[model samples]
Target: MKGETEGRFHTPDVSSITPGPRRATLRTADGVRIEAVHDPCAKGPADTAIVVAHGFTGAATKPAVRRAAGVFAQYAAVITFSFRGHGKSGGRSTVGDREVLDLAAAVEWARSLGYERVVTVGFSMGGSVVLRHAATHRGSGRGRTEAVAAVSAPARWYYRGTPAMRRVHWLVTRRTGRLVSRLGFATRIHTKDWDPVPLSPVEAVPLIAPTPLLIVHGDRDPYFPVDHPLMLAAAGPAQLWLEEGMGHAENAAGDALLGRIGDWLIAARPAA
Candidate 1:
């Protein structure tokens, strides 16, 4: 939250056990310039690359974001990017709708860097983008995603809002939206678009089956109920990590969670 600016978010600098390679300015298909940090340790061409997308109001340099990147870097090249309007990246956030494009761009960027296999990890709204991208790839026969992992992702966008969320939404939309709009920030990014069909993780899971997925959520997460990951697991070859006391992005940084994710990725690697 401290890194959140008027438009973008910034993450803290992470210390790595081994210094990883660095790069900047990976351009996407839509012409938006995405700023990415690449960390490849002990590598010529990496065996795998893990690309991370942060949650709503999160940037590439957040503590959790850095931890996730570090976890993957232990075994593979890791590329972390801030979504449009959420970091040094260009363009506004289209919620998760057009953010799918951002994911695609990130994947392409990773592949271009000589990573033969690529896995995607996303948190919250970032998780939604991962599902959408996997679905889109499966539909187009582009190629299968090696693996996908999500943390605290909501199943639906406009679910029955909790009393707390309702109050928070009211307050933010009323007070914050007004201030953001007056200050020239596009507050409409938070507004939902009307679609007869839902675009959340629940609806997207059925399409991701056979493609390995790991869904981790806190049992006590107030924003997205624990049942969301349960529903997703029911639909795919997905494993659920329900931490008893963790909430929201709680697993985003933990060594235990990252170790589990690393093991999952190693086992789920695509066949050569």
Candidate 2:
């Protein structure tokens, strides 16, 4: 991921490169046309490929997501795209349930580009999607994902008294999770059912053993609390970093977090 400059956001000039900015309309398994942004840098054949997923209401062009893409460009080809209903992507937010397919579509896009090593980074809601993807992809024979990194993600939903998260279940489910069952994918806030695969990153961590995993969270994050990462780290070959005084989605400029991620990637290189 790219670093921040002077505590400000910097957008990558993907058009200046050889292949330039490759724009494509990706159709998810559910037939949603997701607008994807692909930056093919001048760097030689990429040794690794990274696909990034943003948090709720975030788009591919978001400053943090773009910064992450920029940071990864130094060592790997990077791809970022909006989950349906955000930015130019189509459809509505599934609250990280069906969004896993959207993530899969993005990963497939990177694989089609001939990237040998693949890594995925997800923020908040996007983090859950990547964790689910890793669990389901193992031994499926689709392809090998080298590693996964999650930032400010929640291992379990429905936690009581979380400061970072608003009571979205009311808005998401509308009528005590009953409307979701009857209405199905027509709920107002969430267009899909509420069955989120029942798998949390803490439980899924051991499944990803032998494959490096990194979990980063803010010390003051109100949403999931620092215990989420701590529990996750105890599950498998995982490393946890708690940024002091950082809140959920802290806009710490200067690529401070991205640098940590880059260092982890180098140290956690997958086996050959």
Candidate 3:
């Protein structure tokens, strides 16, 4: 890992003494290569690290994504990666269904680095990936996550309500949309429909019980309504944070909010 010096610090600010981020390329179980970066923990008691999964069309190098790593470095180690079909990662995105493998790869990478505890934090579409990943891997007895946090995630799938969502739907549902995605977002996503139907966020939440979960949603989010977070909170053991005027992920995630998430990851680590 590279050495870390400057970044916004939270309560622990442990990352002030930590090393800079280390860059690596990882392969998923399905053999898709994912571009990843790791930030080691600062000199302190916390041995926990965070694995960050970015939202749709977002890469590990986005300004907001990079900023999150800097802010999170204050409290603990962090690993941020681009999902398949985004950035330099290989393979097309199956949206929420097959993205679980992307997260699984990152979690395994964190364990290989000797982190005693790993918490996964995802935003928007990434939020759903973390949820399904946790549920799908729970009790598998291998590389299980210690905690999970979902920000501004949708509870259900195939939502087409808002104008933003409608545009997004077009991107996922039409062939022309796929071309636009490749040109604009550098993401190549599946154009077909889900056959067997993947587990929605709410359906997966129950399976993740006992694993500490934090659900943070903005009340003013234009993508998903408040009911999404409310439904998720009711389905599982989760601490819900309803921001007064939060928008979407990344750009909408301020430094203070990012630091708070760092605090939660630190606090959620398994007790010694």
Candidate 4:
């Protein structure tokens, strides 16, 4: 980071003698084209790679996601990708259901890059996906995650507890709301509801035991509320953080918080 004159502001210069964000298009097991990027660690080559799963309506190229990636890159290499139906990825968003496949692909890609250990960190809807993904692909060497962190995630499905959630439900359920979501948020939500209703985050958390789970939630979040994190924490043997004034996901995650999360990831160790 380069400071401006007279302490006005600092401009981040990620362009170094080393390579920058390596862009790629990954294909999920379900055949979704996931737009992804790899930001090498600022220090140098790293054995650990952090796979970032963004929230609903977030893209790998989005400023918020990129900022979080940059912060994490300080500690380890970072892999950021847009989920299906968001940004440049192909396919409709099943919300969190099939997004697990997208994450699996991203993790596999990270492994192919030769990173010895891979950690997943997600925000909001992405948080839910990481929980389910860790459970769904447990013990699978292909896309196995060494550790997991979910921030501002919902515990169950069809939660209409808050106005923000109600609006989210409307966007995914109604026709006109989908149009607005596509036009305004650039997110293409699927029209159909979950067929069998996959396992909830609380249910998934129990399966992720011994996998180093970390649940982070904000007390003041308008969406989901504190009960969500409480539910997730109660469902498994994991570490939990109840942030005092933090609001939502990536947008609300400042550099300081991200740095702490990075530190946690560095210190996290999975059971053998």
Give all candidates' CA lDDT scores: 0.68, 0.69, 0.83, 0.89
Q: Over the stretch 220-268, how does candidate 3's per-residue lDDT look in tens digits?
A: 8888989999999999888999998899977798999988988997788
Judge candidate 4 against the unseen true structure and give its global Cα lDDT, from 0 to 1: 0.89
Q: Please give the ranking of all candidate structures by lDDT, highest first, separated by commas.
A: 4, 3, 2, 1
Tens digits of per-residue lDDT, candidate 1, 1-272, equal 01111122122343333255554565555677677777773344456888887877666776778877777777777878878766677776666777777777777666655567778888888888888788777632323467898888777775556674564355344656545642453223435444544367777887786677888888888777877888877876677888787777624347777767776875784334
Better of 1 and 2 by lDDT: 2
TM-score comparison, 2 vs 3, better candidate:
3
Misplaced by over 4 Å in model 3 are: 1-19, 42-46, 269-272
Q: List clash counts for every candidate, in order.
A: 4, 8, 6, 0
Q: What is candidate 2's lDDT per residue for 1-272, written digit by digit as tens?
A: 22211111122333323355465567787887776777754375665677887877677877777877787676667778888867777777777877777888788777766666677878888877777777767753534467888888787766655633545455455565435532543322445567635676667778876677888888877777888888877877777888887776524323767766755664576445
Q: Report how far residue 190 has shifted in candidate 1, in Å.
A: 6.6
TM-score of each: 0.79, 0.80, 0.90, 0.92
Model 2 gets an lDDT of 0.69
1 against 3, candidate with superior lDDT: 3
Judged by TM-score, which candidate is best? 4
lDDT of 4 by residue, 1-272 (tens): 11121121111333334377766778887777888887889999899999999999999999999999999999999999999999998999999999999999889878876788999999999999999999988786878898999999999998998999999989999999999999999999999889989899999999997889999998889998999999999998889999999999999988999999999988899766
